[model samples]
Target chain A: MPQPVIAAVGSSPVGRTDFPGRDLFSLALEEAFEGLPDPAELADAVYVGNQSEQYEHQIMHGTLLAEWAGLRNVPAERVEGCAAAGALALRHAAKDVRNGEHEGVLACGVEKMTAGGTGGATDALSAAFDRAIEQRSGVTAPSQYALLAQRYLHETDATEEDLAEIAVKNHRNAAKNPRAQFSDEIDTDTVLESPPVAPPLKLYDCAPVGDGAAVALVTTAAVADELGVPWVTVAGTGTAANNIAVAERNMTEIEGAAVAAESAYEEAGLEPEDVDVAEVHDAFTVSEALLSEAAGFAPTGYGYQSYLPPESREAGWTDVSLSPSGGLKARGHPIGATGILQAIEAYEQLTGVAGDRAVPGAETALLLNEGGVADAVTVAHVLTAGTEVAR
Target chain B: MSGEDRLDVDSPLTLPGFFSALADGDLLAGVCADCGEVLLPPRPACYGCGSRNVDVEPQPKTGEIYSYTAVHTPPPALEDDAPYTIAVVELDSGGRLTGRVDANYDAVGIGDPVELGTRALTDEERSLALEHELEWPLHVFEPV
Candidate 1:
């Protein structure tokens, strides 16, 4: 089987933006195809990851994005798993390449979350939950995650301050990232004192609703060699779905994510200890902690120490650095576009183009993107250093 | 809830049927015959062991708070209902579900006993519901 790799990647500036989804996708494509041929010249198919049709009141994202990229008559479609849609698109492209079905595929994602404002985003996102109970109970995204945070804090040695520190650390990391939404570093007090969107979860603890788009060209070694562009191997991919209802699943364990990550690790022939950096979905502060444990990077109940350095974290914790792109917390969570954004961050880190926030000598990385509340569905990808053809 | 059952709104395995039962003041759960996992608002398949041999059983109305939070910011439809307390309650029968709480955020704590109650959908909830969902009763938890 051919090894799939991400040859090129780009993302629009994250956070509340003036562009529509398609326009944001253009900006991303511009950066991704910067010194290369047009997408139509190389891409044999296109996949777009999109969360909802309610935000921009538009559908047919695959057709629209493909047309915008100047490609036509390609196998194009929109993949949806709420927030995990981007990685779903990437995963589809990777499979197409690995199976020798397509030599070059464009995997892209976009979300104009700011178009309809916060209320619109909330109503749209609620559709990700089980409508029978959780949605009927008026659970917003924050409240759903707060249900987990409340339990996590109660059951663990971690305090609310510890969760706040996760936000702070991400913001500090974002300060060094040009594409981040909130680049200014914040103190723990900022997170602790922010207005409560949900109890035990202040407003700052929640990832801001934003607009973004990202595009990645997934192809085999031949395509990367032909393009002569810096690229990284897409070593493995895994995805899993748990019960959509938060109450029906293991609220704090995020077991679905664990299963997905393990599948990726197995395929990549690696263990968690081998990963140098990761972009775990920190959609909420509690999520980073929960996913840390779930992904095998942190010991049970000690994931909250993610804000600390590797040496400072509890025993059994791996040396893997989490969310060098500042994660969804500071990098911005633009719904569908987030998974592609994560892949872009990993691409930059492994290629040594991550600038100030780069994890030095980073060779392998994990990208975990989730949809719904705490892993209703999850997509994990393992990336190892691949060819970086001379420019 | 039999594996051979053909589902309809009246079937206990379906949400409409489950809500209809809740409207009649009887909480029901699907007890997995294989793993003994209790699925709240009974379904045909068991998530614990992937068993389809689920038995529809009437569950106790009382349970304790497994976790709780207050929605200080709510969806636009329920903006007036901001700061409403909600919880994930683990019942004595081993089934867990979420519902609104009839108390303040500080008034409840984990492990606090609460009794499940049913109320006709309010205008706000009705506004958010579809034509088929209009008749589904909303579950609430009251301090016991």
Candidate 2:
């Protein structure tokens, strides 16, 4: 069986837009096929991932996006798993291609969070939590992460300064990303002085709400060679879920990320040391710290110490880069669009298309996507430039 | 002035109709007969085994703190009394419940022994008061 290769990846300019005549599905579809070499050719099928219909007020988004993208009458399906929506879509598409059901497939992810105001958006996002237990008890995302942050602080020597460093670094990286929501340069003092949304988590510690879409074109390696297209192969993908409520699990540990990374590594036949670059889910500063530990980039509770100081990056610590695309913090998190955006970033970095913030000589890149509070569900994927899989 | 002037009190001694049997000073938890897993908050179904055969049973109220956090910002109703500890208490029957910790920050830690207690409440004239409120049941954990 021939492995599927991502032939092309495209994304909308990921910043706050008026979105007057355009909806999320429309905007994403336009971006997906924007620069296709052959506009007449259509994907054999389409896979769309969206978290909530309540947020978009549009139910059947898969069909709507397919029609809007001018690929109507093709088989289209939508997959939802909280924040893991995009990864799930890719997984389905990969399966279809691997099974010879489809020659080429299109996987797109979009979220119109700004369509709903803050309160409504929050309610939609909170639907990912256990309605009977966590949500009813007023355990929102920030509150759950706040508890984790408290426990993490107690167990580790990490301080507020360490978290601020991560914010500063990502923000600096985002300044180079034209599509990032926060393009300004932020420093450690600015991050630390920001008002606390939840204890130990300042306002800058959270990823911002924005609207965007990302799409990838996946085809067989044989098709890629025939079409004369530059391609990066999907080495492996893994996903896992943990308890919805933080009280039910150990707050200091991210079991879901660990499990997902292990499966992905096993499938790719690669170890943590093999990854040259990573686009981690840093929805919150503490999340970056804990997830880094969980993904085996650093020891447990010591992820905060892994921050490459601004001076250190200038002094050549950029070899092993994390979030060169500004990440969720600076890149803006549109919920459903996050996982797909990570894929696009990985595609860009691996192909040396990341412009100014590109990682040098990047061969193996891993993208980790997380959804829900306290690291509830996590999806990880490893992408490589070479065709290691035998056709 | 009539309705607004009435004194309002929220107490841990309060037991709702669902938990009226607990007013007798016995602890209660909703247990699923099918899977034999006890659940806190007394739900109607068993999440573990996905069984709807659940019944409320009296159990011991003693437990230990599995984990805890000092909440500096309380809910709007509890803003005045800021900086309270909320904990997940693991019961003797291997069940866990989240409630307020009735100890100072330094005194409380993970795996600390705790016992459940109720807050006493008083009504007007100290005569017409019911034993407790029926809606808001407060469960506090004190260092054992």
Candidate 3:
């Protein structure tokens, strides 16, 4: 058995970038390979996470990205689970390293969501839902989430104002992150009054549709040591799939996410309390609240208090910070690239290099990325700070 | 769809078959013989018990709103139909499914009684459907 670690990470500027998908991947690759050999020199395999071909009317992302990275023949493929594609790629690469199948694998994600504009993104994303009912019902992403938000509010003590605060809090965190898309603090009123994309979900409630790319190097311990860069160990990985239709599942609990996170926690031989920081999918404001509870960091219904400082939360809450990278809410979600973005944040946070928003003494981090309307699919990974960094 | 009916187009376990039934005005649900989980738009296996022993049964059209919302922004094909209400209705047969509610945002709430109705796809929706889906009707919920 081998220990897999993330030796390097890089991401393209998130938001409506003027770059295409492959170009975004190239920029990310350049940043990640700086002061090091080209990716072709070390990557034994490559996995690119991309959401749809409709955006650019292009597919075969594996061949395109691998060629762009100057890698010729090594095994390459694209992984798709919508927004969770990035983590799915990382999980595959990490497993390849851990199994001694590959010494170094490139885990990458890219999405040029702005290629077709908001309406284009909307129609493309609608393909993720069940075609028979959900898609035919004219449900946009926000409306699907709004259904959950509506149910969440009705079942919990939380209100629309509480959900609005989640957006505000993430925006405040994003203000400290250079990689974030919306780098300005916002008031709850801004979130409350923003044009309603769906009732119970205003414009601020949803993650922006953006274009971006991210790349991570998953390698064996020796490779990381040789690279002389601070690294983080990939301790555990877990994935779960739920019903495609949101109506079929427990909307309030996000049970699939809970199961997936628990599986990862079990593999790491750790509990929820052991996590110092987490980058859960805040694709929507309600998602942040739901994922907090799913990760076991907060009591049921008390999860909406994530906007408050940990100490100010309910008695059952742990002192864990959520979405310090500002999260999808403010950091901008490039769909496929989002999962890898989570890994990048964890890598930085645990290695003691996360700028202003760093959680002090953070040693362990959790990354949860999801696809589909709710938890149609979810990937959870646990990362621990590695030792003997020559940096 | 456990035995000989697995590939049968007439079986309620398949998508085309399910919609074909809906086109004829009868909603079908798959009840897991083991866990008794009701699967709407009936499928082959039960997610609850992972049982392939599913029994297709006619689902009641009437249900209460388990959850609801209005889509202020919709896909381009339905641009003219913005602000339409939608909901996850828990049917009388224990199966739940989402569909458009014929009402305004403020007109609906959780637990509102509604009944399912079937109709031909509008010209806009039909334009978005595939050759096969052109024949499959659309389903919506009306206040009961």
Candidate 4:
């Protein structure tokens, strides 16, 4: 059976501004056809990833998006799971190609968060949480993550400085990314001096709210060969979910990431050590550290050590070059589009299109996308260079 | 009449029941009769045993803090309570619940002992939640 490969990818610049009076459907349509050679030729199916219908007071996005994108009369549906909506859509698209259900599929993720102000957006996002319990206390993403950060720091040797280091590194990397929301260089002092949104987590520690869409054209390896286009094979995919309420699960660890990554590594017949480049969810500074440890790149209580000095790295910490595309921290998390954005980075890095920040000679790249606090849902994928996969 | 008399079992397996029980000064845990898996903020079904036969069990009011955060920027509902503390309380029943902690942000720490307490919701909030069948009783944990 031929493997599924992402043949083309397109993404709108991630930022807070609305896309020139267009809504999510138009954004999805524009990005969907941007990378394709012929905008009129549509895929066999369309999968739209959308997080909140409450944000736009609109539903049936998949049907609407496909119609607007000229993919009429095909299998189209919306896939959602909070922030991991994009990754889940791609996962479903890969399944379609693998099952011989479709020769090609268009997977797009879009969210128009700016339609609702910050409070309204926060309320919509909180709907993904345990509404009866967690949200009742008015807890939002930053607050839950803040609790996780506090617990992680208490249980480990990590410090607030370690958290700040992640923000600093991500911002520095974002400076090289033309599509990032915040490309300006920031130091530890900048992060430390930032206003505290939640204690132990300053404003800089959180991913900025923004609106954008990302689309990937996934087809079989045979189709890519026919088109003679650059591609990356989907070697492995895994997803896992935990308790929605942060308190119901272990805050010191992201078990979902570990579980998902293990499954993906097993499916790919590769270990964490074999990954040449990686993009893990960094919605918050604490998340990068927790995910690093959970994904097997770093050891327990040492996830933060990867961002620390060399002395820390020497102690059982073989760090992987993380988030070359600036991650959600610097790239801006537009909810539904976040996961697909990570996949885009994997495609770019594997195809040698990632400028300045590209990992040299990268062959295998891992993309990790997560939803909710402490990883209520996590999706992991291993993408190999098309050349290696063709064999 | 006592608060207990007003409490009805009509929705014991639902969130409103959880709040109703809290208002009556009891912490309820939905114990799966098939698997004995306990769920806090009670649910209608057992995720483990795939059974709807859940037994409503009352948990002790005391628990330990598993994790906590001090919110400096709160949602609109909690705007006035900015800089307030919330914790993931690990109940004696082994179930976890996130509730507000009535303590200074600097004073509370992980693993600290806490007891469940209820706060009456504002009239507007209570009426809205009641009309929508939402839980209005605020369950908070205070340092023991």
DockQ of 4: 0.61
DockQ ranking, high to low: 1, 3, 4, 2
True contacts kept of 4: 0.74
Worst 10 residues of 4 chain A by lDDT: A20-29
lDDT of each: 0.92, 0.71, 0.91, 0.81
lDDT (Cα, 0-100) at A339 in candidate 3: 92
Off by over 4 Å in 3: A388-391, B1-6
Model 2, A1-391: lDDT tens digits are 6677787776666656666212655655565555565422747687887888876577676786676666767888777877778877887777777778887888878777777666566667767876433543334455567667767877888898888888888999899887688889998989889876666777787788777777787778887777666778787888888766666566788888889988888888998878878888888888888877777777676777546742443221234578888889998887777888888887777777778988777788888888787468888888887533222
What is the TM-score of each predicted model, taking all chains together?
Answer: 0.98, 0.79, 0.98, 0.92
Residue lDDT tens for model 4, A1-391:
5588998787887887756313544654565455556533637798878898877777787887777677677888889888999999999998888888888888888888877778777778778878777777767788889888988898898899889999898888889888788879889999999998887899999998888888888888777777777899988999998878777676787888889999989988999888878888888899989988888878798888656543458456654788888889997888888888899888988988888988788888888888877679999999989854321
* Two-chain DockQ for model 2: 0.10
DockQ scores for all the models shown? 0.90, 0.10, 0.88, 0.61
User: lDDT tens digits, residues B19-93, model 2?
Assistant: 444445656777889988876656555767888677767778898887665554333333444456667778888
Task: Report lDDT (Cα) of residue A377, candidate 2.
Answer: 84
Query: Which candidate do you rate higher for DockQ, 3 or 4?
Result: 3
Cα error of candidate 3 at position A39, Å: 1.2
> RMSD (Cα, Å) of candidate 4?
3.9
Task: Give the range of the ten consecutive residues with the poorest summed lDDT in model 1 chain A.
Answer: A382-391
Error of 1 at B113 (Å): 0.1
How well is each residue in B12-128 modelled by candidate 1, as lDDT tens digits?
889888989889988888999999999887888999999899989999999999999999888999999888999999998878899999999999999999999988888988999
lDDT of 2: 0.71
